[model samples]
Target: MQDSSRFDNVISRPPASGDIVPISAHPAEATSAVLHRQIRHDFPTIARGEGSYLVLDDGRRILDASGGAAVACIGHGDGRVADAAMEQMRSVAYCATIFYTNTACEELCRYLVDSTGGHMARAYIVCSGSEAMEAAMKLARQYYLEKAQPEPRRTRFIARNQSYHGITLGALAVGGHKTRRQLFEPLMPQNVTRVSPCFAYRGKTAHETDAAYVARLAAELDAEFQRVGPDTVCAFVAEPVVGAALGSVPSVPGYFKAVQAVCRKYGALLILDEVMCGMGRTGTVHAWQQEGVAPDIQTIGKCLGGGYQPIAGVLASHEIIDAFSKGTGAFIHGHTYQGHPVACAAALAVQRIVAEEDLLANVRTLAPILSGLLKQRLGDHPNVGDIRGRGFFWGIEFVQDKTTAQPFPAADHVAMEIAELGVAAADYAVAVYPGSGTVDGVSGDHVIISPPYNASRAEIHTIVDRVARLVEDYFAAKNAGGPVDAKL
Candidate 1:
């Protein structure tokens, strides 16, 4: 029999205090051919992944607590997904979507449409979340043109501040993430407008009730629509749960309903970007379900493929599809790899596994446990200002002064430090996603903890424990006036 202990023993021990480890700028970086995200930073080379742990080439096991920005919903190294991809590749790997539709793509689209209980009439599969958002924006424009009256004037979009939709030029224009949009402002489409997000932690007043806040936000959106000439607006874009741009920020009660009403009033479609928070990342398969609002056009990714393949999709409502079916009978948009069979097959397999294993139920069951433990561990910490999220998608916002809820200066890079230390230190070899601009677009820091949907009770506890210890020790060191360096 093979020794299972061989892999387990790799991460059995932690380095002693003051031991120096090279976390960045690996020796291979000097002549590495690949252009890494950070030129100077040396990333660990992963040999393989097993369940929730990533085994490095050097034989160290690192716990993947954040699921690599909440993409790996089913964890790593599932042979079933690989087999599905292989099978699809063996049959037909590359077929231009314009020329032909494959079984895998058709099945996956059907599955997505059914998942929405037929509310979404069609699914346009793409390669990434950015492409999905781009498709959604273009489709929204086409939707207006497809109408009987041909409202060609509908060219503008209203998106929430501190919200991210995608990275492409079109998607970036609609996104309100200040930092990401700053350099690209001159090149972005000028048709998009901004409105205040429904973030209760910062946007809500101390004296205001949830209902009052919702009304205030709705009024702001309405006022913006009027200011922009509602007839020119194509849609109101927002993230069901604000992802990277604002950490895992969820809206207050009745927030979506209020916004949807405003959108309807202005004859604008509601586009909810669930790239990071949907597909069972939250308790529900679709985050908008929890909000009690179904978007006219929804973009889903990340967990859609569970990191098994590069796939994202845009779901269109029946009304939009009907308009298209009657008008041009074509979307007038195309991508070379729109519905690659291998990608669709991999995503289909992942989604089936999620449903067959009943992972959403697991997520719902563990949501409270994860939230309770996080609050119990870091709720009262001097620097922990807020802990908010639903299901496994939680975020811990760090503040310079908890009483005043003042964020640490942007120069401090608090979130990145915690994330880097979590991966660098042998004592806490766990990974969490970091966000820099949680407060506005330039200041504040928060870390997202999005465990896999199929994560066990014990795995959740382990994740929380490691994260809490990292937070506590890091702050303790800061309080002691020490360097608080992960490296020696």
Candidate 2:
């Protein structure tokens, strides 16, 4: 056996001046070689995870309320998924797609396609949501080319404002998150145009009905198509429930149907990027299932592998697949780790667990409780602007004036402060997903509370209690001229 005493010394050793600090402490100087997301911030080192709680090196257990960006659906450290990945690795770990296909990949793909209930005809697995989106864009373009009457002029794409697809160039080009795309604006494709997002809280007028709002949005899309020449459009992309960019903002009722109708009218394909909100995050396996419409191509990730492995996929409709099969008989795009065996195995295991345990049912059951508790606790708070989401995915938006719905300035970083405070308080150490640019991509703040699908009722209560306390305390401190930073 390995020498266990060797680790005892390291574990018992006192911290040096430059050693990494706990979640609540801030190191004066940078000590690590790795380039973290924020160079100035000191992050806690997680020792291990158990279900809804993440234990730090300092022995404090934090509640993973956001599931690390809503990715951990089955929760952390699921042994069944680990075993499945190990088995796949032992059998055949890395087989190039050009040479051979592994059973794990095939099985995962088949399972995904079947879950779609015939809406999505085929699945093309990739390593991340960005890659899947890139693939979807390429395939959408290729599908138009493979048509009986090729419309070479159909090269333009239309997406929404305050939307995030992915990080890669192609995905970024099609995305509308202004802060993310600001520096890379010159590099983004000029063919892509943007429309207003389907955010009811901000987009809808006081007197506008849902039907009228949908009609107005649809008309705007139609007008954009006309402005750019209808024959030149390739696709219209959106997310059923906006994630990160607008804080889990679900579209108004009939919005997707309206947009899909407009896309069909112009012969442009509909591509839904469900990277942050798909794969059973919002009760249904696919977010579009709740809506009355479906996209021609859809990209999903985050919860797909349940954070066990990196995996995402493009789900193509039958109509698009038929065009490809009848013409090129292949998708032209490729990725180095397409349909990786171990990733596929892990995802397959995660998905199987979701199905066998009926976690979607759990999501459906708990969604109302989460929503109700959040509203009951934080609804009357002066800064709490909105509480919106479906299933386990929810966002609490902060505003300076609730009546006016005016968002706090981006400079204040209210969402980040609340998130940091949540992580710092040992009594209520809960991690939430913070987001900015909720209003027009520069000036709003919100935080997402996306618990794991298997989180118990007691866990949900704890999450709400902690998060509500964090929000209340943060704003109260800020209003009273107190230090609101977690490090303070």
Candidate 3:
């Protein structure tokens, strides 16, 4: 494979004082101290990116594996996306959705609706995934209020534990991860409950059948709705394939179908937060389509504009839209950057490329290549406890013992180690999107591997090979009575 660190630019490379950063890398001491997420060594400042490679400020080129948390779907330095955004900016840059709408917004909405199996209902463009989640919560509630069943449906939402919705107050309220919610638990809203995730590796009981597991989770949802008083619940939310919070774990067969049935039975709308898993990350245009279930309300972002411009949108089903259309004619929500022409135009360009090039096929084909390569390369590694994922999205979960499926100690910083290795040892800049609480809310460690849809085979191999080598080396050094040096 080509050298992963052949970048063309450089910024904050390691200082001579040694690569060990303080706990926070607080500034004011020596070299440029920036408390980066991964303190492997000083991070190289990226100058530019092209295709699936990030050009660092120091003239080194690095393979981009996870697409910056799976955001850069179309690879880097795409002139077409730039042209589209520039054209929209020249025409109309800002028009808040509260006052009026623009042609780009209208066209983008139409494009999304037509692509989503013609049942788009409508689109509400927001600024980010967290904002989209916040919008989805409010919108789901409004749908019922407009339908005149506000009292019975105002009580709750059912989300899965180890699933990430967002960090906003309402989104975090329904988010189930314990550590994320521990500090502000006293400040969160009531009525939102979390259920066990559909993870088979960790959550599945020994000797339990997949059918039985799905049935059990479905029953759990039903019981939660009943506990909250079924008539008072607004929505049951989950990622079609859980991301970040639980790596890339998908539910067992019939999981969504069964869960959807429970929501139908309880008269609560089903909300799928595909912020990290949707928009062809899982091969299909929409992740929910693979499960044979559709969401009443769905939130999608990340790949929506392929990171060319910040954009997120909630896909409302026709029924959800009709309730508001007939009752209030307004959704009772507002955003200053909603349907910003530049974001919509950028998204339109991305969607057009995806459709025209049939990139979903690329995602489908490359997914197996990526998954198989990772497995074929590192399947027997003792530290790799599990390899799970779907589509272009994937994850590698580490454990102290594979047979017992034991995660490395969190303080051991397994995920953080691999993340730093990507730079210090391999010269790659991939994403460490998910980690922590793999066994619970604070003990396990896993790293997400979501390559760009436009990544080439050479780049993917570099990513896989380097990551495997890095992980193996870290353990090897630690086993040899060393500190598992972060400087490599």
Where in model 2 is the C-alpha error above 4 Å?
Answer: 1-30, 485-488
Which residue ranges in model 3 land beyond 4 Å of their true spot?
Answer: 1-19, 22-43, 148-153, 426-434, 485-488
lDDT of 2 by residue, 1-488 (tens): 11111110000112333322335355424575655454444556889999999998988888999998788998998899999999999998898999899899899989989988889899999999889988998998899899888888998999999888888888988888777788888887788999999999998999999999999999999999999999999999998998888888998888999999999998999999898899999999999999988889999999999999999999999999999889979888888899999999999999999999999999999999999999999999999999999899999999999999999987676776677667777656998888878997878989899999999999999999999988998898888986654542
Candidates in descending TM-score order: 1, 2, 3
Which portions of model 1 show Cα errors greater than 4 Å? 1-22, 26-29
lDDT of 1 at 484: 70
Candidate 2 vs. true structure, TM-score: 0.94
Error of 3 at 154 (Å): 2.4
Prediction 1 TM-score vs. true: 0.95
Instruction: List TM-scores for all candidates, in order.
Output: 0.95, 0.94, 0.91
lDDT of 3 by residue, 1-488 (tens): 11111221001222333333422244433455654432443445779988887887766566777777678888889999999999989988999676788998899888777767966689889989989999999998888788844554476788878767777778888888777778788988987888889999998999999999999989888988878788888899999988877788887889999999999987888999988889889998899889998889999999898889999999999998888888888888888899999999999899888889888888887778889989998889888888999998888888889899987775565665566556544333454454666677677877788887766677777778777777777778866766655442
The whole-model lDDT of each prediction reads 0.86, 0.86, 0.78
What lDDT score goes with residue 381 in model 3?
88
Clash totals for all candidate models: 1, 0, 14
